[model samples]
Target: MEGFQQQFIISVFIILLGYFFKRTKILKESDGQTIARIVFNITLPALVLVTFNQMEITLPLVSLIVIAILFGLVAAAAGFFVFRSADTDLKGMAIMMMPGVNVGLFAFPLVEAIWGREGIQYFGMFDVGNAVIVFGLCFFIASYFANGSSKFYLRETVSPLLRSIPFLTYMFVVALNIFDFHLPTFLLDTAEIISGANMPLSLLLLGLYLNFSFEKSWFPLIGKYLAVKYGTGLVLGLSLFWLFSDYPMLANTVLIGFILPTSTTAVVYAIRYRYNAKIAGTIVNITIILSFLLIWVLASFVAYH
Candidate 1:
């Protein structure tokens, strides 16, 4: 309990530190976008490529995927339950939770650090599941709310994935690992050093970036995001852990990844599709703020052994 509490406190502090620093007079608002791009395009990609690609596929890998997909479905159901009394209902809930997850370093590496290689192993396996359902369904839901037909342009929809150089690099790395295409130790060691550097640098940059936007943004939207997106996903995550405590570590990883705060990139999608960027950004921010509490309760339960 003590360790869990400590970890939770640190997580909350880091998030608040970012929020508060951004509110102070350190940088201009434009710097936030600059920092975000650097994280996404550079450091994050390096981390993903090294970690994700180095892992090999196996039955356990498949199990992780199954777990992620099932978790996604379960979360969707919970979101529906949350909004049952609302006029918009499940659609709103789905848009809030499913599509809003930050799948890259925002989630995967954090799980890795929390649980170790086993922690991130599930990330390599389940990230695909997270990608397809969370982002995919979010797009679908957005289309569902549109005035015309409900179907989306599949090509444009997956264009991001297609152009994801890091993801592509990861695929090759995994293929090599699975095929036993053993590389020199120096190469592996190099990957280890570089991949490991990603998180600290990116987090620092995030800190630097957050130093720019301290002013109040959108509290109401943040509140709604907390209630539906994070609130529903987190509750479902905790419930799943309580039930599957036998596989505590795996359960913990998947649930946290799902229950994690909305990715800021979701705001880009919201703006691109005209789905409500203000709402999505607030959801992302509040989710980041609240997830530490939910994750702590869950890790305390699941990692208790």
Candidate 2:
């Protein structure tokens, strides 16, 4: 319990340190992009490789993948219904933001801090399904609404996932795990060294991207979007917790996974699809703040209990 509290404090402090760097002009917010790239292409993949190298594939782990996909689908459906009366642009933005969770960048640091390698293994499996939703389903919805066309392009949807190094790492490691194969010791050692940097770098990158600016005019829409996103998450996450209470780690992972901030891809998709990027950014920022607080409170409560 003390260890968890200490790590959590360190994580929060590191984030604030990054924010401090940004505010003090020591590191520009845009620099986060470069860090993000490094984290995604290098540190993150390294972490994935090391953590999942020897992980055993089981029904529950596989179930997490399925659950993540289903959860996104449900959230997307809820967004569609909730924003049915809104304009195409607003509707598209809402729906796009709904399905994906920022597990990689947002959840990894805290999860690593709290549960160490064990937590990473669980969320790692869950992220496999999240990657599908983020790259596959979210992209399709963004494109569909952006062009107002029903056309589906296979390459367009799969291209992003294919290009994702971390996602590829997940696939590579999972395949190896299934065949009961292990990478060379030297390779694992190198990956372990690189993976050590993922947690701090991710937290710092998040701090750099944190922004509190948003138009007051969009408050109502943001409110509606958050309400639907988190409201659905709470209901589904808690229910999953109840069902999976026998597996505390899986249950906690699911609960935290559901409440994670809107994926950063939301803003990227909004920009690509010509939706309102500012609104998307604002919603994501707010979610980051909200999720940080909620996770802290919830984790602390669970720790004490």
Q: Of the candidates shown, which would achieve the greatest TM-score relative to the real structure?
A: 2
**Per-residue CA lDDT of candidate 1, range 9-128, in tens?**
554455456556666755545666776665666665556555555465666566766776676666666655654565453245334455445656466545655665666666666676
Q: Please list all clashing residue pairs in model 1, or write none if there are none.
A: 21-211, 22-210, 22-211, 22-214, 23-214
Cα lDDT for residue 279, candidate 2: 90
Estimated TM-score per prediction?
Answer: 0.77, 0.98
Highest lDDT: give the candidate number.
Answer: 2
Question: What lDDT is reached at residue 277 by model 2?
Answer: 94
lDDT of 2 by residue, 20-95 (tens): 9999999999899999999999999999999998898878788889999999999999999999999999998899
lDDT of residue 183 for candidate 2: 98
> Candidate 1 vs. truth: CA RMSD?
4.1
Give the poorly placed runs of model 1, Cα more than 4 Å off.
Answer: 1-21, 49-56, 73-100, 205-225
